[model samples]
Structures are given as structure tokens and as C-alpha cells.
Target: MSSPEQWTRPEPGAGPAATAAQPSPEQVIAGLRATAEGGAELTQLLTPEGERQPSRFDPYLADIDDAALRGLYRDMVLVRRADRECNAMQRQGQLGIWVPLLGQEAAQVGSGRALKPQDMAFPSYREHGVAYTRGVDFRELLGIFRCTDHSAWDFREHGFHPYTIVIGNQVLNATGYAMGQKFEGKVGNTDPDGKPSGTDEATIVYFGDGATSQGDVHEGFVWAAVYDAPVVFFCQNNQWAISEPTERQSRLPLYQRARGYGFPGIRVDGNDVLACLAVTRWALDECRHGNGPVLIEAFTYRMDAHTTTDDPTRYRLSDEIEVWKHKDPIERVRVHLARTGGADQEFFDQVQADADAFAAELRDYCFNMPDPPPERIFSEVYAEPSAALDAQREEYLAYLSGFADGGEQ
Candidate 1:
């Protein structure tokens, strides 16, 4: 069993003021309300101008050198570029559909990078950024959109579960995995220096604003709390789930709802990459130490339609989109880099060339990829193919191969 130090929170109904001068839960809640109303930014590290904030979160930012920060910026830009290409490919009838993460790159990348190799991630479809961070081939992501494969990569190899399309459905799966990590005795173990080791595996699950209304998400919360599972419920509150605005989802702010489930939750400026990184690091560390599950409502916006099938113009105003343009995560980082970190024309040119080359390679791979044999479809449908399934497979293969030229002219 984990020691008492594994968890850290005020005793039941005990407020922070009793031990420290810190604000109580009610005061924290009220402060958050005031902050939201004033449209103030919720962040712990990194300023809009690319400066680091002075706080505990600063330690996380300390090791990130200028080159590393540039790399982070590059990752966000490359992911967005891939997103754009995929969207265009779908429009051109190359893909069945594409989920664009135009405005949520920072939220995904920052949180995604915070994960350790031992950690597991369960993500909703929009977490293409997370997939990239886990070393899943960027072009492999297109396989699902192209209808060529059920999932592009093996989950176990990448520490990523298959992308879940049904909103909030993967939350329970994540909680279960975290519970498994506990049962495997991965928690409460430390190295020689009395520090936690890789044996402490945590899980981070991603969902959207609309998923909060789903029964699966609520059940996930309940299970994680009951088992003390090492999981973080990462909600990217992008303000819209299809045509529905966030206002229609719930009355109270999303983060505070965690209290009802007996967990800790916080809201961060999702557009601010540094803040997302800091908050996610905190959340993951807490989970690894057994102080979980944590709920993070990343306050962000969806800059594009829900998917290729929907059009935003039908329900939203152009001015609203324009307003979010200032909060553009990529542009903000670039501005900070250029103004403070001396990101000059040469750096910009090199990054752009690299991005372009990457996109070209992805296009080539996607277009030239060979389709799986028709018979292979039913191969994994069952542990062992039943007589009826075998007969059906034979029939289909025969019918498919019966075409005058072996199904090919």
C-alpha cells in the first residue's frame, strides 16, 4: 500500500486556511469565477511575450533552453500544418473525414509532452498532437481518415490507446488502465534516493466540452475516485461541441465540478502552451504520487469546424472567430520567439522548409499506400473464425476474385 505521503489534500471539509494562509476551496472557486468574468488569463508559467513567470511552475520551465523552446514551437506548427493538409485532403475526397485541431495545438502538445515514456494516454480523436508526441508516425494518422485501417499504429508500442471517436467513451478505459498500473504494484515505489521511479505509471485521458455531459465520463470519474486511480481527466473546453456552445453544456465552470467527484481540478489557459505544460506536469506528478485523479479543464477555443462534415458559418459569427485569432497559440509563441529569443529570418526559413518537406512526404505516403487485401478485413474480427464466418469469408473472397481480371484490369 502507498504511504500517507502518496496523497496530499486537505482533510474532508478542511480548508487550506487552517494549515496555511492559502485561500479556502470556496475562495478559490469564487476567485476563479471572478477571473473568468473578467476574461483574465489562467496560467502558471510563460508570459504572452515569451517571458517566464516567477513561481513554482518556473522550475519546470527552467530546463527548457532556447533551442528546446524553439523545438516546442516547431512541433506545434508542424502538427497544425499536418492538420491543414489532412483537412484539405478530406475536402478533395481523399479521406472520409478529418478532425481539425487548428486552435487546440498548444493544449495538446504541452500536455502531451508532459507524459513520461511509462505513462499511458487515452485520447479522443482530436489528440493528433498527442499521437505525434508519442512517436506515432505523423502520416500514419491519415490511415484512419482515409479508411485504410482501423488504427494506424500499435497502441502498446507507442503508449497510446486507439483514438476514441465516441465522446468520453475512453475515460473509463483510461481509469481501468490506471487501476491496472496500481494492481501491478507500479505505485508507491521509490528509488534509492527516496524519489519516485518509473514504476509509478499514470494515465491521461483527453475529452472535449461536450463529453462532460456523457454518462461514460461521469462513470470514469466515479471509478477513478473510488480506486484512487492514477489518472488525469483532461478536458479541452474548446467552447463548442459541433453547433452547441459551451454555455449550453453546464451552468457552473467545468473545473469546479471535480469537487463533486472527490478529486482535485484546475483550469488553465489552454492557449498558453507554457501554462498547459506546467499544469499538466503538476497533475501528472500528483497522480504518480497517488494524489489523483485530477481534472483539468483547458480553456481553449475551436478555430475550425467540428469536423469536415460540419460548417461553422451556420451557427457562429465571423467576428467570434476573429476574436480567437489573437489567442492563436502558434502565432503567440512565434512572436515571443522572434521578439525575445532572436528567432530571425534564417531560423524561420529553415523551420518552414522542414515543415514543407514533412508535408510533402506525408502526402506521398498517403496517396501511394496500398490498400489491405479484402480478405484481411475479417481476419481479426474473431479470436477464431467460426465455420459460418469461414464460409462467408470464402464466399466474399471468391466473389471478389471472380472479377474477370482478378478484381483488377
Candidate 2:
């Protein structure tokens, strides 16, 4: 046995007493809410007021001219319109459910545009803007929401994997795929002139801050770190994971977690399209050079409910939503374009018209989409024919046939 003073552990820090130094619950909540402005670590090239900010990452955006910037703005507008249309359709019972990417257009489109043709992307469902950049037809996505198809686009053709509904599982898939790329010598290849040989490839996996707590995500991080896989872990930290706040998930910022896994971590203002493009370009370049894996925490906010089924008002304050509205991703780009004369009123009108047409096309496609045959589910279960599955399919069809004219027996 030791004396009380000898056995006592020292206070953790040099501040006041431990309890006195700690922040109250209200303070913590306030801090979490104030994070909408991001921190000093955040890499931003565009301000909420639509002013351009100089950054060390500017070199990565040397290729983005006025035309390209206008294109990015157009992409965000169309994506946002499509998202709103889908959400409305879901409410009207056209889609089974809709996952709206209302405030995340910049994060998805900027990073999506940064990808080369050979790169692969694994998305965690709400990456509609990315799908657009990957050459996936907007009409094809309607099939998934309408429940007429699992995924209509070919992954090999688009370099975009089918959406993963299971939280954080796509990270493991992307990691394994990246490891395969390394084993095949697809990364870090160079020509005799010390230039890229054009065979370099990388994989990017998208996840949410909430998924960081999942065991699968942790395991994926560890495996990627140990193997040095050319995978970029893109965490869209949209503040809330459903009803749970980011503060509840991790004490440290999400990007800081990469240091523990032995990789570089970057935090970018996800609402700034220019910054997202620049940071993603740098991260992809690192992966192509085999200096991966990197973690990017995109500081964004989700301005809509998690899905058509969620009611955000029950969990979050309207004041917080109003605060984020001032930082709307699409408006910033539009303002920048107008202020700088990068785009005129004609350009804005045309983009809005195009977005309206796009939404109309999506609505038409969803309304006219045909339902899949009941046996369609059994068809894709296996590569080779299975007798047991065939028998089960026949049994299911026969059972369905027992009803008269598709009505109850």
C-alpha cells in the first residue's frame, strides 16, 4: 500500500484542475456548431462571399480556366436540380426512397472532375454528382431509386462501382482493389523521360464521418496503410451522421485520424469547389506516385434530411440550417462567375434551362420505368447456374402464379 499522495496520478494538463479545465456540455455543443467555418487546417481556394483566395494548392488548379470553372458551376446546378427533383418524386411516392445530395454538390463534382479516365471510385450511395462526372447517364441512376434495377451502368465502362448501402464496406472493397493495382504494377510507372507512362491508376473510396467509427473502416485503413495501397479515403464530414453529431463520433477532427494510420491527412472546405478540385488532384497525384494512402476530410454540411424518410427538424435546430444556407456551395460558384465576368446572364439562364430539362427527363424516366420481373433478383445471384437456386426461382414463380390476376387468392 502507498500513501495517498504517492499513489495519486498527476493531472493530465498544465491548465486548471481537470474538471475545471474541461468544457461544459453547452460549450462543446457550441464549438461543434461553430465548426461550419472549419479550422485553420482547412484548405480553401474560394470564400463563401464568392471571392477567390490564394492557397498553396493553387498549382494543382493551373489547368482550370474560366471555361472549366463555368463547367463546374453548371455541373453543380444540374446535380442540385436532379437531387431536388428526386426528393420531390420520393415524397410523391415515385421512388421507394431518395438520398438527396443537396449541399454536397461541390465536394462530389470537384473531386469527381479531378479523376483521370483510368481511376476508379467506390461511392457510399450519395455520390450522384460524381456519377455525372464519370460519364454515367443521369437516367441510369433513376432505375436504382425506382427499384427497377440494381445498378444499370456498367462499372468497368464508367470506372464507378455500384453504390454500397452498407456503411463503410466500400472502403474495404476499394482497398482490396487498390492492393491489386499495386501488385499488378499499375502505380508509380514512369517513362524513360521521367514522365507518367499513362498506366498509373488509383482508387478513391467515399465514406461519411459516422462510418469512421465502424470496424470495417478501421480495418480498411490499417490494411491500406500496411500494404501502401494507392487508395484515397475521402470522408465527407457533413457534420451529422443521421441524427448523431460529429462531436459524438470522434473527439479529434476526422482528418487527424489518418496520422495514427501513418498517412497524410488533409482537411478541405468541401463547400469550395475550387479547393475540392485542387486537394483531390494533389491526393490523386500522390496515389499515382505510390505515396499513398491519403485521407481527405471534406468539411461539408448536409442541408437536407439523410433520406426521404428522415425528419431533421426533430434533431437539429433551424438556426444551424440557416447558418449553413449562407455558405451554399452552388451559390458561391454562381456569384464568383457573375462577379468576375467569367459567365454572363445568358450562361446562367442556359444552365438553369439545361437543369430544368435534365430534371424533366429524370421525372419522365422514373414515371415510365417498368418494374423488373420477380425472377430478376435470382438471375444475378451467381456466375454459374445453380440447381438449388433455379429450383427456388421456379418455386417462387409458381407460388406467385397461385394468385388470380395478381390479386390475393
Candidate 3:
């Protein structure tokens, strides 16, 4: 990991030794453009054209053989299919709203698959791919968009927290959880080589570029940094916070913000699943062995609108979208698998069939979902029964009963 001091230095030409301490107008304009290339600092194991590249982080991916690589490709395909189905369902009024993870499949799946069973994840609302990697049922997530339940799965069992809708709030929750893990001595056990040798755990919090501007995220950084909490701040820089471009959020790259908080930060090619997996594994290992609270900025794009209700076309150009389409995460992986003979046409066809079935199942579940009764909300509000709450529930139920047949009054 590079030291914080290294990140603070001005780029060779931008420092006081050059023209000025601040960037030139042209440099600022360049910064505002969507950086799909991720500049020179980007850690990439596979190019957008599906060519493999070597990196220092390659050792972290030793366990990912050709079979595992094919599995990763399948995961992305299924996730993208499910995402599209949910988006269409929302349009058809089957869901209240849907958050699309269309272009971020590699970022979520790679990082998510890096986590151990004991690790915890706190996610922002658009983490359907992460949820899938964590063994969460696709139908359970549908309940959230259907407005039928908060989250149907056991978060503790899954090592995944309920999807947080408010931006950056999950950072605080994840920091606190990591602090607890440290307090319980779940971190810092390692061998002489600094590799984990005991029962060590870590936490990862997922947020977006827009959330970087939030006070909660900054506070989480400060607290996690000061305590050396075992948390990885995973920011998927999808280039837009709704219609607002990432340039409007910060002049510097998002990953560089970690230097000020006293930890190492890295930028990875988010569209390259191989790079994401390697980099995330390295970060998590650092955290487990006590060198903690790393920041990872995944340089990716949002190929679709932010949410079902959002309109990306209003703020971004068609040309920009066209450019990112060439870097489609799933297509690159598919190309790599085919090129390497890791998978064949039969395998690709099978994966497509499976994804189609997955999407169809989700659509069936959403359409047939039973609406909860008004009194159902009161059932889960308290672990211990409360007289006041019971009275309120009783009165509410009675009020509903007074209607012609339930709700026709």
C-alpha cells in the first residue's frame, strides 16, 4: 500500500515547480470528463477489449481458476438479467421503484465474492448483485421494491445488512460494526508474514460517488481511520449521482480522499471483474491483519438511469453512453472465457438459459406477491409486546373491520 504522503503530492506537472499549485483550466476540464480509463493509477487485470494483463495483485487471485472465472461470468449474466427484469417490472407498476445495477455487475460481484463467510457487508440500495453473491434470495429483495416488507432474509445469517436507502448512512453502521469486531478481538491475528492465521473478520461498506459528499461518509472515514477499524470503504464511482456528474462532487479523484483520513486508497478498473476481485481481496487481507480501513474507488459507469424514476439522458450525452457500451462488463468476461477456451458455446447457451429462468422466476414472484394487511406492520415493530402499541394495533384493526368488507368504508 502506498503511504498517505505519496497521495498528497501534486502530480508531476501540476505542482508549484510547474505552472501553478491549482490545476490549469484545461486540466480541470479534463478532470470533469468521465474517466472510463481510470488514468495510470487504475489497477486492471483485464482490458476492456478482453485481453488479460498481469499485476502485483495476481497472487490474490490464485484460487480463481478457469472454472471460477466462468462462474464469475455466469454470476454477472444472471445479475444483469435480474436487474433488467426488475426495471421492467417497475415500469409495469409491479414494483414501487427499482434501482438498476446494469453497468456495475463486475464491481459488485467481484468485491462481493471476495468476502469470507464471517465478513459483513453494508450496502446502498442498488446492490442487487452483491445480495446475490451473499446468498440472498432474489425473491426476498423483491419485497423491498414491492413495499411488502423491509427485507425478508435473515441479515445475520447472510452476513448482509438490509439495503440502506439513505446515501452514506451505511458507512457509519459498517464502521460501528467493524469497531465491534475489533473490540471482540475478531481482527489482527496474523502470521509473521502478515497473513491472517486465525479467526479474523472484516467489514465492507458500499456507497457511491454522490455519497462521498455526505457528512456521514466523512465521519465514518475519520472514526474508522482513528481507530484502525477493520472496514473497507468500497465506493463504486459510477460517474453520476443521478443526473449529476462525478466532477461536480470533487475536483480530485474519489479514492484520493482516503489519504487525508490516514489510510491507503486504490483505484481499480471496476468493469474488470478480475481486477476488482484481486484488489478487493488484497484490501480485505490488509484489514484482517490489522492494517485497516482501506478505501477502494471502483472506476465504472452507470449504463442506465440511476433508478427507475431517474433520467440519465437529461444530464449525460449519448456519445458518453455509447463509449461505455464498448466496455460492457459481462461482454468482456464472456469474450475472455471464449478466447481462453475456459467455456464453450454450449456453456454460454446454458448460462443464458439459466439467467432467463432466473429473471422469469423473479417476475413470477413479484406478480404473485401477496399484499400485507394493514395490521401486519405492527407485528414486527417490537420484540416484546407493548400495551400502547397493542392498543393502537387493535384500534387500527377495528377501524378496518368497520368498513363494508375490510376496506370499502
Clash pairs (backbone) in predicted model 2: none
lDDT string, candidate 3, 61-172, tens digits:
9898989999999999999999999999999999999999989999999999999999999999999999999999989999999898998999999999999998999999
**Cα lDDT of all candidates, in order?**
0.81, 0.88, 0.88
Per-residue lDDT for 224-322 in model 1, tens only? 999989999999988777976555456566888999999998888888788888788889988898776999999888899999999889976676677
lDDT of 3 at 95: 96
TM per candidate comes to 0.87, 0.93, 0.91
lDDT (Cα, tens digit) per residue for candidate 2, span 18-130: 12345444544454455556887899899999999999999999989999999999999999999999999999999999999999999999999999999999999899999
TM-score of 2: 0.93
Error of model 3, residue 47, in angstroms? 0.4
lDDT of 3: 0.88
In angstroms, the error of model 1 at 13 is 36
